[model samples]
Target chain A: MIQFDQVTKRYSGGVEALKNLSFSIDSGEMVFLAGHSGAGKSTLLKLISGLERATSGSVMVSGHNLSKLRGSQLPFVRQHIGVVFQDHKILFDRNVFDNVMLPLDIIGFDRREAARRVRAALDKVGLLGKEKVMPIRLSGGEQQRLCIARAVVHRPAILIADEPSANLDRAYALDIMELFKSFHQVGVTVLISAHDETLMEDYGRRILRLKEGQFTA
Target chain B: MKHYLFLHWQSARTALAKILRQPVGSLLSLAMLSIAMALPLSLYLTVMSIQDWVGKLTQTPQITLFMEQSAETADIAAVSSALKTHPRVKGYTFISKKQALTDLEKRNGLNGLTEGLDGNPLPDAFVVTPASLEPKQLELLQKELSGLPMVEEAQFDASWAKRLYGMVDLGKHLTVFLALALSVALVLITHNTIRMQILARRDEIEVSKLIGATDSFIRRPFLYHALWQGLLAGLVAWGLTAWLIAVANPAIAEFAQLYNERVELRGLSPLELALVLGCAVLLATLGARLAADHHLRRVSAN
Candidate 1:
């Protein structure tokens, strides 16, 4: 569960990314954050993942309070909330399998078990056949799928993506949405920020619209 | 426990693979590490071996008494009887003026060198091995014998023994300073290497951070890198020191033969080897930890 109570995030340059925002995400709800560029969508996801602390309000992630938690405790919270970055953040040096295998390695999963999970996550994203290929050789859509595979490899309770389908074609975009939907079906709380409104329309999940730094009508 | 070992083994392999990918750079770094480590180790061995050899010998300080050339047989006999009765004197050998010249000639094989001399220039001497090697006691005995009739001078080479100990002390200090300086240098080398590695793999680090990798997990491969480097450097240094000693021992033995003794120069003991390797690993690991931790903080803060 993720809860934000009047959370306000102010960057170092005095730009308010989030202002007096309050919201709650239940354990198994799939929500979409809708806004154009500069609409605090990324900041919201960052807060949920414990990547950034709120400037003035409480941000609670899965019973762990982000504001009061120590630095060492942040990783434990993050381990339960997988984050897929907007830029894809896929390691270009490693093959697809190693890229996805990272999260399990961090949590010290059993070796054979981790291998099975890596291949399983790869199979889920339809990248199983390309497990040995370097991420640089993968197409943009396939690379995006690679990021999703890495995010879900550890089977996190909450999965959040920022602009997951921004540059992909319409079909691939829908396919990405279906992937998140499938995870939500398995009782994984999913929150995603996207490039536009129509991409999230068919899902019928709650859409929180933001303008500037506050939620809009 | 099995899982922990596997993780460590994986980390170590990862580190080794990274090093192997750039053979020349890694070899250069290892070469630098070994030379830095070898210098002090070799010096310590040398000083320790010399000290050990010197310690095994007698510590008894001998006092030599030179008699007047004009002294009669009766005066020499009187001095000898006096030394025999002295409680501080353990034993004494009296070399006459004639015997001293002949012995010197025989030792030098210079049968004709003394013929040109008008008479024997060497003095008769008594070498007294004192019962006590104490400096004060030896000094007192020397002074008492110097005042004896027909005794021109009494001498003991106490300063030679003092000089040997002084040199050993100085060698130890030099070795310690070198070791300390080299250890710091090695730490800094490892820090810089790991810092560059972190920068080069910034994407991995940042992605790992977002995906829930802990600070220690991110830091593991780099620590293993340094640990392996340190261990390799230590082993190479030991090998280099051992090789250098083997080459030097023959010359050292030959020199000892000149002194009518045999010396087999010893290398570092097994315990010292373990200690050197342990220190190397510890220092390198510390360097890597500091670098990785500093960068982790800056990366996470952003």
Candidate 2:
């Protein structure tokens, strides 16, 4: 479960990115964040992922408050929450399989176990047969799927992504959403932010709309 | 513990693989480090060998005590007794006037000259070798021996002994300063190398951080990379030092032969070579840790 109470994120130059926002989502729930550009969608997801500290108030993920967490403790929190970056954050220097194996390697998984998990993750994202292919040869939608595979390889408890469907065609974007839906079905808490209202509404999931860093009615 | 060791080995292999993939760059780095290391190491070895040669050359300083013509055997025995009881005197040899005359007659150039002499003009002498070569102590011992019964004069050749000691002291101090300065240079070089590596792999590192990797997790391979670099540099420096000594040994031997002496420059021993490798690895790893931690902290802060 994740909870945010009176959260306000003010950057160094004094631009308020999040303003007194408060919300809670139960475990195993799929939630959508819908807002236009500069609507604090990325900032909100970053807070949930432990990538940024809230200037004021509290962010609670899995019963631990993020603001009060120590620097060393932050990684442990991140290990449980997998994040698919907005720009796809895929390493092009290696094959698709090695890219996904990075997370398991971080956790120090043994070779046999890591290989199994990597193949499983690749299978989930339909990249199992393309294991040896470098990321440059991957199409944009396939690359997006590769990012998803890498994010979920460690079997994180919470999976979050920001603007995952932005650059994709309607068909490919819908396919990517279905993949997140599959992870959410297995009792993984899923949170996604997208500006496409019609696309997000099709899932019939709860949507939190933000306007100028604050939620709208 | 088993898993930990396996992960460490894995990191080491990955680090080595990266270096092997870039042979030219890795060799360039190794060349820079080994040459820097060899400079002080070679100087240190040369200084030690020179001191060793100097010690052998002037191992004993003998003060000669020439006796008066009228001194009898009793006077010589008294001088011998005093030298035996003296704490500063290592040992002494006696030469009666008759024995001195016979030795002079047997000499290569002075054989005929001694035949023209009358009544063995050479004086009886005692050659006293002191245990301590300290100039003040030698002068004091010479003065005391000269004041003894029937002793005409006492003196020792101290200039050569004094100059050798001074040179040895200077060489030792010079090597110390050189070693300290070179160690710092090696560390900074390792730091810059690791910094470039971190910057080149920024994408991989950032992604590692984004998905649950600890700062240490990301730094392990880089530290291992530095460890390999340090180890190779140390080993190469040892080889280079040995090769240099081999090249210089003939010249050193020829010089020694000119003085009817034989001195061989000793290269680093196995234990000393091990020490160099260990130090190189330690400093390189330390540099890597600083470089990696600094970059990681900055990335996490933003």
DockQ of each: 0.70, 0.69
Q: For model 2, how many clashes? A: 0
* Candidate 2 iRMSD in angstroms: 1.8
**Which pairs, if any, clash in model 2?**
none
Q: What range of 10 consecutive residues in model 2 chain A has the weakest lDDT sum?
A: A71-80
TM-score of 2: 0.90
Report model 1's chain A TM-score: 0.98
- After superposition, the stretches of candidate 1 with alpha carbons farther than 4 Å from their true spots are B1-6, B56-58, B112-114, B259-264
Question: Model 2: runs farther than 4 Å from truth?
Answer: B1-4, B56-60, B66-90, B95-124, B130-139, B149-153, B157-159, B300-302
User: What digit string (tens of lDDT, one per residue) describes model 1 on residues B145-187?
Assistant: 9999999999876657677888989999999999999999999
Q: Can you write out model 2's per-residue Cα lDDT over B1-302, one digit (the tens) per residue?
A: 99789889899998999989999999999999888899889998988888887787666778889999999888888888999999999998988888887786675346666567676788998888898888788888888988998999996755576687798799889888988888888888889999998889888888888887888788999999999999999988989999999999999899988877898899887888888889999988998998988886766523
Chain B, model 1, TM-score against the native? 0.89
